[model samples]
Target: MDELTEFIQSNPDPRELKRALAVQMVLQEYTYFAIRDVLQVSVGFISKWKQAYEIQGVAGLALEHQGSVGYLDNEQRQAVIDWLKAKNYWNLNELQQHLEAVYDVVFASKQSYYELFSAAGISWKKTQKRNPKADPQAVERKKQEITDWLEQHRHQISSGELVVFFQDECHLLWGDLCGYVWGKTSERIEVPMSNERQKQTYYGAFNILSHKFFVQAFEQGNSEFTIAFLQALLAECPESRIALIWDGASYHRSQAVKDYLASVNQGLQESEWRITCIRFAPNDPRQNPVEDIWLQAKRFIREFYHLCQSFSTVKWLFEFVTHRQTFNFPKASMYGLFS
Candidate 1:
């Protein structure tokens, strides 16, 4: 039988409990019969340990204790409050010591400390602010304006006239980000490993209409890089003119970009090559289709790959996506992004 299945048959939390029992039995030099005879537990429990041993080898028998009691009584709780007042902060063990010293109270284990703090509505969570680039009102306005433009020009933008490029900066990093991997569906896990390595940001541009992709590697995306990327992108799609859609970033709207746009528009021999700008309303990344694409890319990377330990991991991830998958949900992509 499969180890997991055997473990499942042996213990409720088959993998963990079976291993725990097996290790305890080994460490204590107790046989299954001896354990059952002494502890007066069921033979099934012993069988679970034996099954866990067979499945995981010795490592399967690791013990993890779940503490029984929740918290200290009212007196000990008040003592904790007093300590908090005096010290401003205390680690679980420190608080445990203080409880024992001041209130003569003792908790069964460290997990119980969490239970106590939870009951008291105290927790340590670091709040992260969103990227401080764009303004919210401007983003909303940009989204609405873009949606209106899309609605109005729906007929004009066939497979030929409208080439929408979703462009953005992607960061590389080390190790798997916790939530992304834990949240992944099994289909995501089945993706083959990527060969690329090294930490670098790639300026990615995606054409929503054509499902074509362009990438430019950069240490970062400043005004100069953006201009160069745009020039390269212009070179790639020499046939159909692309309306440059970007956020109202300092870099994107820099004097350098304005100068480049002026030069490009001036040199446009045909009406199609004439560069028109669609600036996302300030802070509203959703107005730009590239934002969603980048987010989905990041999310996909974060969901799989235990090797996602550095920015290089993030870079490798983008390369994997670009090479492996074609764009899907173009309309929904536009809607969700521009919504």
Candidate 2:
């Protein structure tokens, strides 16, 4: 009886204490049936408690539900929810410190803090990196403009009078692209590499309608490289009007590049076939299909990284993949943006 009293007092969870008391009553010669009738617990539960007591005594009866009670009430939890919504970043350590400093509440363990967050319907997830300075209104306006342009040229594009190409640049390194790999517990797969991360840069354009690609290796992505690429692209489609969609990199908007565009469109009428440039909204790379092309190229390069040892081999691999026309950029993905 003394031991049962001590156990009930020491144990914090009411449910566990109730079970312990039931077991103690049975130990003192009270019938299991009577205990069940009084406590409104099943006979099987009484047996479980008795078995637990037999195995490890009072310690076994201490239910592992300390953090289940939760530390925050409705108002405190709403405060946490509001705070999380006001920011774009958070980690467990920072949150733990915040709870203590702001609410003067301390969780016994980090797990408890996580449990609280989970209970509050908050979850941790990896988010895509976005530029904070990007203007939403500007992005919306650009999207509308692009939608209208595409609609106006739908017939021309279907008949091959106008061609749209998305262009971007990417770099590939000789080092192992660290990604998920299956390994036995306590074992690691080693990827050998030289100290110098030899890399190669490439400029690429994908014709969204035709699904053809033009990729060229460049020593550096600069105004000179961009101008040369544009010249080659114009040469490829001398008769058809070319609408090159690209991001607002300094090289793309350089004075030399602007002059080159001006010269190309000097005598071309609004309806004539010539070169025109369309700039993607700032910090919006997902809208560009060429960015997807770059991602696919890099994925291929990383998957077969062992074959690419030198810069020459890397360049060859990139050219091989880009020239094969294997990458597919869905037209629906582009259409979905406007919707």
Judged by lDDT, which candidate is best?
A: 2
Cα deviation at 318, candidate 1, in Å, is 2.6
Per-residue alpha-carbon lDDT of model 2 for 69-112, expressed as tens digits? 43778798878877876767667756755664345455667787
Model 2, CA-based lDDT: 0.73
What TM-score do all the candidates reach, one by one? 0.52, 0.61
Candidate 1 whole-model C-alpha lDDT, 0 to 1? 0.60
Clash count per candidate: 22, 0
For each candidate, the alpha-carbon lDDT, in order, equals: 0.60, 0.73
Runs in model 1 deviating more than 4 A are 1-128, 131-135, 175-199, 211-213, 267-273, 302-314, 329-339
Worst 10 residues of 2 by lDDT: 330-339
Q: Could you tell me which residue pairs clash in candidate 2?
A: none
The TM-score that candidate 1 achieves is: 0.52
